[model samples]
Target: MDSPSLDPAWTQRQRPPRLERRLGFADYPQVQNFLERLERLCERRQRYPDLGFGRTYVNLTIYPDQDATNVGDAEEDFARDIDGLLN
Candidate 1:
């Protein structure tokens, strides 16, 4: 395997596979559905944190130091699974 270059900001950037332009829906139903999904994900994260792997991880930059890191990690895994399903 080729070794990566020496870079200071390599881990901080999230580059997309490709970039594209598109219109976003601002309609009521779309907005409502989005809010509902966000709420549901939050609830799931709070209620059940061990839905994915037994191990959990958390990023310390955003959230306050707490015991819910496992839950957040599970939520991310859950979201990624849904994205995979859709694609």
Candidate 2:
């Protein structure tokens, strides 16, 4: 699959092509809220990104779904939706 244009906040990585982004939160509660919202989003889209987090930040890695070698429109759109969650 070909890589699609991604949101500026996301970085495209090679090897096993994926999109990565780190989102910072003001505090633990904010991070918790973001995670909750992210869970809902994932359920709605049926796309889940690998996630890592701390008390104040979340690191997410979104991999191509079916292709396995490149990011496609679905992944790009999902990343964009996640960006929207922060706004």
Q: On residues 1-87, what C-alpha lDDT tens digit does candidate 1 reach at each position?
A: 643332221122123111111213346565455444544765755632222111221111123125543323433344443233222
lDDT of 2 by residue, 9-56 (tens): 799888889999999988999999999999999999888999999999
Report lDDT (Cα) of residue 20, candidate 2. 96
Model 1 per-residue lDDT at 44: 59
CA lDDT of each prediction against the hidden true structure: 0.32, 0.89
Name the TM-score of candidate 1: 0.31
Name the weakest run of 10 consecutive residues (lDDT summed) in model 1. Answer: 52-61
Clashing pairs in 2: none
